[model samples]
Target: MATELNTPQNRVRFGEFEFDCITRELKKSGRVMRLEPQPAKVLSVLVHKAGEIVTRQELIRTVWGADTFVDFDQGLNYAIRRIRAALEDDADAPRFLETVPKLGYRLIALISSSPNSELEDANHTASLPSTTLPRLYWVAIGASVLILVLFLAGPAIISEFRRPSPQIAEPVSSIAVLPLRNLSADPEQEYFSDGMTDELITDLAKSNKLRVTSHTSVERYKNTRVPLPEIAKQLGVDAIIEGTVMRSAGRVRITVQLIDSRSDQHLWADSYERDLNDILKLQDEVATQIASKIGSHIISPTDARMAVRDVSSNPNKQPIRPLNIEAHDAYLKGRYWWHRRGTEAETRGLQFFQRAVDLDPTYAPAWAGIADSYAVMAHHGGLQANEAMPKAETAALKALALDDSLAEAHASLALIKFSYYWDYATADEEFRRAIELDPNYATAHHWYSHYLVFAGRFEQALSEIQIARQLDPYSVSINTWSALIYYYQGQYERSAAQFRSTLELDPAFGPFVADDLARVYEQQENYPEAIKEHQLEWTAAGRPKDGELLRNAFLAGGPDGYWRRRVSLLKPVGRSGIGSALQLALVYSHMRDREQTLRWLEYAYQEHSPWINFMARDPEFAWLRTEPQFENLESRIGLLASGTR
Candidate 1:
């Protein structure tokens, strides 16, 4: 029952079934049926080369591509299973894809005519209009096509895709949660409103049925110049949720609207006015309504109760008093600036967090915010480890003591533990506790993923990152982290793609993404691309690391003039950091300045920078690896230092 074919045309005369590749539809006895992408592709591949033995590797390479991270065996099996499901073919008595023992799979089916030929029949003629048509109609069509091209190809494409639709779909599977805007007369209360918006996003994200965009992902659109549909398209969501928060005289009013993204339609709208004690319930209610509007599976009362279970073992404990509004406001301000992550912003965040604690000593959240701010500052080596680490730890502990259920507090503590003390066990405990408190907290998942990566639990790190991505689907930071993980795992192509995707979302991320791509390309032995990506990163970052790396990569690519250009660039900056010395050594080696290379190596050894640890492994230093001076320099830096100590 072997069949033969050519081209991407879908129709295959095999037994009694016809496979339609165009619509990804399968028809048996003229009845339409659904098929998943993988299965459909497998079937198409088989149909196109019927009667041929498709080797396992060929099948995999054709269907999933060689670079695919999926397990080929598992993917092949899954695809065959889906095909069997569609064809009603039993494994024992296969209609097609007969397993050739010890070799590959053979498609045994009668494949006659190209699927495209079937469209020639009058009744089954292609639905599309003929290329040649009435002149007036064609003119109209040309105008329409021109308009379409303008819209699709223009810069407004992104904005247009983000615009809200006016018509709601029957089934809403995707959504964007726009940041809640502050409608308060006093703009100073903006931080509190923003925090509420973030909390709402968290609550919505907990529902697996709804594809809720993360708070951080959508916060950038608070005062967006882009169109709603474009934003929706950028986030890959079908709908958008927007709201305005107003508070006055100990009362809060929140008005929210849900828009179907595709049609720019408003699907649902509601307003709530209540005391702050009802904030938790209000968020839950809003999430429920959104779920209902979007046709999410209704949670039974019992399930709902379970979902809202308290983190504390004692459920009957009295609720704590709300923190001072002034302190909370200050904390929010601090967090607002902290998220900005610039030099001035970090300093301002530290100041505000401190002021918050001063205003209200028992404000646990504010304390945690202070801890996180210090930790972030310490990350960039802007603050002394002793000065920042202890303060961050103290604030985190105080926050936890005041409110053990605060996930942010636990996350901050975990960060402090891992980054400063390297207390793996304590960090793990705190991370677990944070997840228990707020399962949807993206930062908890992100940091936990990072911890697993550093601990060499790469697969677990990937899983954690996946969870973070699910929660923060559109976050540039999360995407960048994913790229970095891939880069670390030596999946250069995938890492480069992810980095490029990050840049698409935020151009400001170009430098970091380009740097990763440069490293990836270098490892791939694509020296030209490596040099190109490095140059891009250099232009974007203009940092010492970027300049040094670009120069080295250019030299590595084997261009004669590159070294001279690099030396000229470095001469202006002077030597700084481990990277600078490494680059200098590389340039010196290229120029046969053995003495200069040794001097730079000595300088690098004197500085115990983390990158120095990679001296033995970095392929860039291979030229100097055999020298006695280089060996001595490496030994001095303790590049082979054992963690057992």
Candidate 2:
């Protein structure tokens, strides 16, 4: 029999399981199961009430607090799944967990404890509350796992324990290198200056001591009205680097400053003026100096060797004449607008890239920039991949033709291979090459994570995303994508919890994450929670997909006229858009309207809409799975019960 202990410090225990009410960690058989932070909290409550039934309403309020407006079931379900996975129980069978039907779940394991030890641990834990435990546990973990965990203590503790902590940046392990602004009056020579700024950031990224934010996030700060402290705070960086570029005739001059964000003090500053031929060496020297002043470790021989390959050192790359400054300026302009991510800005981005290439046809990076714009269009659904991919491929190939060492060009090509061709093998090759060329290329890690998820490699996917998270620690966009990976991997409860955490950081991401939460609830047969989340999501998106999906959740023939009206509104306008039609069929099928369901199902298959991939896994289609039409459709779509593709 496993020894049992209950202390004022410890909440409960059963068998080898221990729930430290204060710490919110579930240790089973003496091993920590890396539970996503929130689920660990929900489990803490359940462990305390082990023998008694925990009501759904009570659990929701306790886990999510009273002020939260969102539906809590998605979060609750995710918590249960994470806890269950940790317990190593079969989801389909029952041992420690017993679903009490409509009321709630009850933990069925018998708990036994020795009298003396239980009293001591409980007393130790009694001095702490659940909220305080998370921080204390993190401090313990951080002290062991990372040398600089104290810097992230406040933010990490709040995110983990769901309460605000001290407001201070941890010792900085991650930072953003903003572009060096051009102070020169000769606006025409701005490109040469901007190019130097970008090159310095690239050089510094090779240092493992710092995780640099991607160029997109840093570009938002250029020429902005925000103060350095505000910019650093918003980006969650401990320090910031600013610089200015000036060029006269054919020579270039650069000035740089490094600021300690917390104290608003200038840590280091430097000035450099050099000829066109010395530009590359100047950038490398600036990066080295900044690293030295900012307490970064000595640059490894690998980094030094790579920097030595600069064009300034290897004169054979370009002659020391007047540089093509206009082309470099155009490229910077393209990058500036590209980061804005709007439809019109995307169009302007292409114009800038084209102009850069026209002025300097041999400019490999400009071609890579064009490839990036096309890839963005494909990603945002503005252009179908078929149209966007060819242009992306062409531009990437051109960039590689001039500079095979260009990481961005490899990333652009890798995107096409992953998104369109579904060629995981080639996509892996391209991404690996991109990282090899520039180990600090965050996009390579981000995109490869998606490939890992779709290929059913969940552990690898998490590892890749962890690297991306290190690079873009404060990017709400990257965080949202991380949640999506959990959702697709059937880790709904974990996914839902992460999505909720993401929304706290970025309210604008709420609508999308809400829709995702509704999907998770519906899959779990939690209809009431599903409907409420769908309602919230529908209002936020103001889109037909959400409302239409919600309507399906309620179309169980209880109200015939209501079902008919909802169906009419949801039906797709055009015959070609079969995705919408599929939604209508699902609603009708649930409503017992067999004739309409079969009709739309036939139409969906014929249109080859991607929605057909859901047929085998969709809970809505559970009834239809035994039908001959379902088999035929599955066979035609090449979908199997096990994820075929």
Top candidate (lDDT): 1
State in Å the error of residue 584, model 1.
Answer: 10
Candidate 1 lDDT over residue span 1-645, tens digit each:
211232323343455666643333456655443344456657766655567787888778766554323446755775677688768777677776687886777778655332455443324333222321232223323433554465456632111111122244367776777877666667787877877776566566565566666677777888765777898887778888876676766666676767777766545555565566455566677777777767673232212211222346766534555536677667778877876776578889889989988997877667888888887766554565556778989999887766676778899899878666656678889998897766667788898887776655778989988878876766756777888787766677888888887777678766656655666775676766766766676666455464556567566656555556556656642223223555566567656678987887666445322234445544456677778887776555443232311
The CA lDDT at 321 in model 1 is 55
lDDT of 1: 0.64
Error of 1 at 65 (Å): 65
Runs of candidate 2 with Cα error greater than 4 angstroms are 1-173, 179-199, 218-238, 244-253, 260-265, 273-285, 292-323, 474-476, 511-518, 524-645
Residue 475 displacement in candidate 1 (angstroms): 2.8
Per-candidate count of clashing residue pairs (backbone under 3 Å) = 25, 19
